[model samples]
Target: MPVVESTTRRTGGSTPHRAPGRATRPRRRQTSGLPWLLSLPALLLLAGILGYPLVRMVELSFQNMRLRELISGRPAPWVGLDNYTKVLSDTDFWAVVWRTVAFTVVAVIFTVVVGLGIALLMRRVARGVRLFMIVAMMFVWAMPQLVAAQAFRWITDSDFGVVNYVIDKLPGVDYQNHSWFVNPWQGWSVITTLVVWAGIPFIAITLNAGLTQVPKELVEAATVDGASPWQTLRSITLPILKPLLIIVTTLSVIWDFGLFTQNWVLRDGHPEPQYQTLATYSYTQAFGQSRYSLGSAISVITVLLMLGVMAFYIRQMFKIGEVD
Candidate 1:
């Protein structure tokens, strides 16, 4: 009878309940919330900075916020989608958009191709030469767009430019007095060259980093199996580096699409209205002509286009991941 009473005391009425291996439901819930709680501050900061400005820009895009209204401290009149309608209906706006697209496509394609070539070459070079090449590329990459434009202007000058002098020396060419910026196409060619040259360093460096991760054994095995260099690259290296290539290409497209400083500085303030990019065109509308609302609309369109490209890029990346 004593043993039975002791057993009951130990088993039920007096013993404290404890879970040794697992946490209680409430404690698990608290742990789950901790990550979100920790992230709240950063999220709020981003919302205040990035989110607020984007919202303000969208609001301003639909308003008549010309320079005069701003100067007079008047509340902007909301005009619904008039700004977008005006921009969309304008032939010049469409022309600029097309020009921007063409320039971006050309620049990104050349940059990626040349960058890949350079990365491949770097792998074959001696250590010392590779270092020198990397340093030179970094120097080019570090140059500001404005500074590079100015430098190129000096190089491509009409009378005393080194480029003209070189052209004069070339067979069947006498361009010593050539004023490159006078012609829109010539100006564009110069801009493209400068853009490609400036962009190559970043692409090459990033691609080289990606290349390092590619196994030498795989390449060697492919070589031993009678695969040509081009075949191996097409079948192996390219597939491995696809993600990095996409990232770099997308970034290049975005950067080149919004090209401003190079084109503007190259045009030298005598900008041929016909040759203006979306960025230059928007600036012209807002500050040059005091059409703030119209300019905001253009800016918004540019942002939307970029977002679309990014969305497509992300979708492609996910598809590739799923396939892998």
Candidate 2:
């Protein structure tokens, strides 16, 4: 019996007297269950946050649903893509889309270029000076976008605007009554200015961080080889900063594309709404005209456009990562 028990323990860790047919190994349930188990919470959260809202939005966007429908609990009448077609056909909508694109491009250019200069400047400073510049930029970044717009409005105001007043008083300068709010292009200039100001901090902070990562060894090596300052920056520093440059540029485009407050606060929806970005166009349709379906369609289009831009950026990001 001892020999048999020892044999059983050595072979299968089972007693010799145990039922051979009935004895079973423990099964690993997680091997079968892990995917479903892990996905349960995410699926639940997605359903809770997105499922109904998206379905309802689609339904509403196809309907002539007004506040009356909410009051009566009646099924909203389906207009069957009228909202979409109308939104697409509107000249104003096209104008807004163009405006958004222009704003995004111009603002991104200035923000990235100016930000790169600032970042380069900060890179040469002592740690104390670097931190101070960063903190000051952080303050501007932290301010509300609307407040920034209003403050810019004050700065560009015809009479009280400090900038115009200063320009007017300068010798041989006939800056006379430069009503920024009146001219179409001049109004857009203010919008661009505010967007640029609001956007600089993002690119600066990002590029500054990028500058820190530029290999000192590579720069020194380049300098030792008789590379000029500009040459060193172009060949050595910029290559290292490329990834960050892409990110900062992409983000700035996305930010300025959705800008509404800068244009709106500048003129309070005046002058035939020439500078209305897509966001404000959607807002005007939804709230200003109480055209919920049309407005929702515009919202859907803007979202889709932004999504396209996001996909492009994501693809570029992956390319950068692969290169790295």
Candidate 3:
């Protein structure tokens, strides 16, 4: 009998063989251009609508576009960096910048703190109470900014305002015909209060939604492990909520930094020098004083500042994502 060849190799065992004509399947691409292609039309439309105005504003910043040039419809002569130089050199402009920053900081802090508190309260409340709170907040949020501003204006009005009336009701307190806007501190207080009030609903609702994602199991575990409420919140809850906190804080910063309508309406369309913010300053320069170029330069600077803030928040978000 002929000796049979062994199929198994000596090192390991029998070697597995592929079928003669089978081809390996190729992997699908992890990315595709289809999404980008589909998005092109909307992107182009936005570019046309928003991009042109931004470009025009930038172009205007480099030119001497005064009332005369605007009226004549003639091309304004380019003045290079003179507008920027003038704006930067003005002490009043710097004052406005500092004021704006201060207001933003205070408003954002108040909004976030109070909003977070309300969100936590919502979590602990009965279903009916929570529903009522949500509906009330929705109404508040749905109210137009202008309407809200106007309402605040009326409430704080010097003559026969409810705020003064309520204060006057107290013994030894004379608030009759009291003007809230006479002093800068009082005026800014009113503005900040309005901002915080209007902003809280959105922040609370968003944070409440974020709070829903917190793991109940982890919370219970912490409780069983003898963690106090504060400790549990600080360690377990906060870490989970960090990402959302960052987002809401960033949004609040952006909104408060660009404060315009409230201050404008509160001041009766003519804010005193001390009351001027970056938004109002820019508006006053362009429309009020016809210094269009200077206003454009200020606006460009404002955009750059906001961009800086956005960049910082975006970096933070990416870092959190990596950790996750």
Clashing pairs in 1: none
Question: Residue 216's C-alpha lDDT in candidate 2?
Answer: 89
* Global local distance difference test of model 3: 0.94
- Over 4 Å off, model 1: 1-45, 313-324
lDDT of 2 by residue, 56-170 (tens): 7777889997767767999889999899988888888888898788878888899899999999999889989999999999999999988888898888877788988899988
Candidate 1, residue 270: the lDDT equals 49
Highest lDDT against the true fold, candidate:
3
**In model 2, which regions exceed 4 Å deviation?**
1-55, 70-73, 174-177, 269-271, 316-324
Considering lDDT, which of the candidate structures 1 and 3 is the better prediction for this target? 3
Q: What's the candidate order when arranged by decreasing TM-score?
A: 3, 1, 2
Backbone clash count, each prediction separately:
0, 0, 0
Provide TM-scores for the models.
0.85, 0.81, 0.90
What TM-score would you give candidate 1 relative to the actual structure?
0.85
Q: What's the C-alpha lDDT at position 118 in model 1?
A: 100
Native-vs-model 2 lDDT?
A: 0.83
Residue range with the least summed lDDT across 10 consecutive positions in model 1? 22-31
| Of candidates 3 and 2, the better by TM-score | 3
Could you give candidate 3's per-residue lDDT for residues 1-324 as a string of tens digits? 122225353444656679999988999869989999999999999999999999999999999999999999999999999999999999999999999999999999999999999999999999999999999999999999899999999999889689999999999999999999889999999999999999999999999999999999999999999999999999988899988898899989999999999999999899999889999999999999999999999999999989988997888888878887
